[model samples]
Target: MKPITALFAATLLASATAAVADDNLEKLGQFKTTGASPEIPTIPQTGPKADAIKKTLAKIKLPSGFKISLYALVPDARHMAVGPQGVVTFVGTRKNKVYAVTDRAKSGVADDVKPFASTIDLSIPNGPCFSKDGFLYIVEQNRVLVYPAAEFFYESPDVVAVPIVPKGELIPKDEESYNHTARVCRVGPDDKLYITLGQPFNVPAPEKLELYKKWGIGGIIRMDRDGKNREVFVNGIRNSVGMDFNPKDKSLWFTDNQVDGMGDKIPPGELNRATEAGQNFGFPWYGGGKVRTNEYKSETPPANVVFPQVEMDAHAADLGMVFYTGKKFPKKYQGAIFSAQHGSWNRTDPVGARVMVTYLKEDGTADKTETFAEGWLTSDGEYLGRPVDVAMLRDGSLLVSDDFAGALYRISYEGH
Candidate 1:
């Protein structure tokens, strides 16, 4: 929230100039000093994998006038960022790759899917978002990288990438773990980078609570575009993988996955709203909603702990979300919130793996929650696909990324 530091401003200027001066730098994929580039492979778009995803689409149910189809085949697709020019959609994965899905023909389906900046080694790059002016920021497990004009330079193997938060600086290296390390980010209306940092524990140790609180683990942090004036915007989140700013109010809204190990139906998932900075969404103290976790049941919670605007079904593992700002959707869905439920991992009976819609009241609070699209869970308790993120294309169509099936599904309104 403070002014951008002078050092960061200088670095930003230097990076900006270097990113645009493409001719001066001799590069090979990730190696700017060498001429040898790594072999970049493209994801197969037509094959058994695509066929399987298309077959599963038959079971998906949507409201009248809505239809769903296969968009792209991206392995381990966890999150998405639609290019400002609408030429490509950069999909991030939990593994080591970020894919670029292009609809060059202007067709509904993607014409090509390949690794974006394949030379760069990315670790747990689960979040990729673009600023309005076309800067692409990819949030990895322990670092953050920005690609100036990424949509334009992504076709080349050696796209210009500058690190905003270098390795081990996003979080303590000792605290890094595979669990809860998939981060999601959004460039807020204030032009700041907002990122979620999930604590790497089912329930954080009491001694680590203050440490986590201080570094924004299990919470969201915001900084200037150049990675300056970084501060904890909100704390006390269990692990939120999805968030978006409300177009009408510019307030931040996100989904939080609640604690596990409680009974299947006890602690509910969360869809929270933060109207201002420095707010706390109860985590260790209260798992979700008013349900208190055993770890902090004896201790008192912080004052003014903001509760969720909507308490979702427990263990749904709600992930990426987006506000319906497109004109293609019906009037009732104009300002609604659409989010993905990654489904329950260890529940008695599998639940979720569907898309949900939350309609907001006039005052910007949640009015009701409803199932927007479903059928990923079969009658035999099998998951056809687990939806992880939801993004909007320029045409007002919705793109849902399923990590389970390694595909992206497109939802559009065609009318009855």
Candidate 2:
């Protein structure tokens, strides 16, 4: 498990970019890609930057008996996937790097943070998810790559990388977007890989809606582990950066960022539930809740367009979420949904640089939503740190990523 040489890194990148579809993962899994040479760079665990990030956390507010601490210094940390063994956490970014943050000593705070597979050319590698069986899947702008046994072997530079969806195949290259291109994924209860594809435009032209629907853009799609049997799971979503499966019914729940430019107060954000495949969640026809987007207001929305289960305040820019399945939290917090509000960028008065918790009723539907953590926004409308995603560690402690801060914060509960 030695580090790869600079020559090997460059060669591997070329091969991966040129003929990624021809990769023989089964053969590569046999340690055929091993090499020895330069080690990847690791972010400093303690430095001025880390200390600066900690000072900002002092302003963060959580419920009683809870504490927040700096977990890792991950650059552009967007969504996160905790390893099955709790040995490592693969964090995705809106840029080209996928970081591996490790708490190898089980010290509660991460001691090591470094780029995973630093040689590979990653494009907006914003979604990293793990299956229970030890595979790490990273969904990029137009490709999906999986690393076998990623949790245990990510330290090695030559760890096997396999493509689930080859380059430029996740979506049409012509429709690729810089905005709304940050994807998120999860391994579902049924062992399928679910990914969200955000449609590029603020609101697409009416003529392109049908094409977007057909291509699964601005929606969620599912496929087998090997990237076979791919199909659109849900449609009519504008831009969903986060999703997760409910432990209760195994149904899919997600947060969608509604269309902009429809005024600051109209058309609230959405949290939706998809009980079955091929369901539409109401996009262009109804922007958010029953508020219709002006672009397609005159047109008739598809029949049976399912609306949001909970309509949040407009322009909160809701992103990643996870279900609470850990035991360390109190019973009241168990089974609740924890989500991140990335906050609004263009609103005259900013809102939602916080973490949210949604409680569910006995019937498994959302009962109510409330703020769980706040103070990322200052009184003067300046953002101290914009929360991006929330993930659960094996110990039931919560890890929240902030791209604005380039760091991760850990929240643990200790009863009085």
Candidate 3:
């Protein structure tokens, strides 16, 4: 072959190698496959009907000096994360989409609700959390993705999703189930990303215990923002859909939904606290708190199993929770935990469907649990709305996301 022909062949080989490298990088960077951008879904622009919403609001009971108002309409709003600037609030869902509730005028209420990152293929994208530096992290059923400057780029249709944890990495693909699939995420005080992966069974089979423990199922897992240094933070939780780090002690606190087969009054739901790593909260063995599960009643339980800080009503379906550090509410509300009980489906009489406040002592332990807001569940056993997650705006007011009503609400305090 001629020298020119040989040189051309070498150049072609170099180009091919570079192309392969670029493809690899794209695959590793995004959660989805390359060249597979899906059409963005159309989000509903309208909110709930005024008369119906007002009627439901009238039924709600709150402590004196507090008021609740509809903030925005977000479909399937499961968990929420407020942006650093308090401009955009990202809402996630068990469905395949996320939303952005924008407060453009710096008002407490949102001006617009729009679909966010609709191009990405999200599986049970229910947890949205933001870092102090403006990076948004989302926890899907089997992976976690990060969006840098998400608040600014959220409006752009071309915003990219960087996969911190690749697909099928959080759990085995075959083990995934619709039940307990929605994972909640939070950026802890130490700047690590923490996520809860609920075990997919009502009670995990005995044979699967080793695999579940190895994968950190039924527990909380933490990792660096880049998805490195992953480890289980806590174990033995049944299905915790909400978690937040205490602003005072930086200890991790969460809400765990108890087993269902037991009577409605037994195996109460839990508001748990983890002060140290590797703590086990007692699941399968003890359904919630100290209630021994029938499946594990005969087996020897693990020693040093941690109990809940507060035992909520059984079948309350406790989901999202946050530690109140804002000043908008009364001074007494500071350091309190505001949680959303999404309500139960299996009980003879449904409970929850309301917001709960767990007042905490100075030492960061729960003092007492009380209903902060109720009336979503009517006396006749109808649900007008089911609160899923609780979030706080910069002005110190609270935002509650209700998936049943497909709406978000704001709670503020005005002394009489």
lDDT of each candidate versus the true structure: 0.91, 0.89, 0.86
Number of the top candidate by lDDT? 1
Q: What is the lDDT of residue 378 in candidate 2?
A: 94
Worst 10 residues of 1 by lDDT: 20-29
> What TM-score goes with each of the models?
0.92, 0.93, 0.90
Model 2 compared with the native: what TM-score?
0.93
For residue 375, give model 1's deviation from the true position in Å: 0.7
- Which rank order by TM-score, best down to worst? 2, 1, 3
Residue-by-residue lDDT tens digits, candidate 1, 1-416: 33668778888987776464333232432446323254567888998878888899988999999999999998998899999999999999999899999999878999889998865667899999999999999999999988887898776777778888876899999999989999999999999999999998889899999889889999999999889899999999989999999989999999999999998997999999999999999889998999999989999999999999999999999999999999999999999999999999989987899999999999999999999999999988999999999999999999999999999999999994
CA RMSD of all predictions: 8.5, 5.2, 8.5
Tens digits of lDDT, candidate 3, 1-416: 99999999999997886575445446635543444344544455443474577568877999999989878877787799999988799999888889988878876666778788654567788999999999999999998889887898776544557888988898899888888899999888899999999998999999989988888999999999999999988899889999999877889999999998889798899999999998989888998889999999999888999999999999989999988889878887888999999998988889999999999877778899999999999888889999999999888899999998888888999884
lDDT of 3 at 94: 87
Clashing pairs in 3: none
Model 3 is weakest, by summed lDDT over 10 consecutive residues, at 31-40
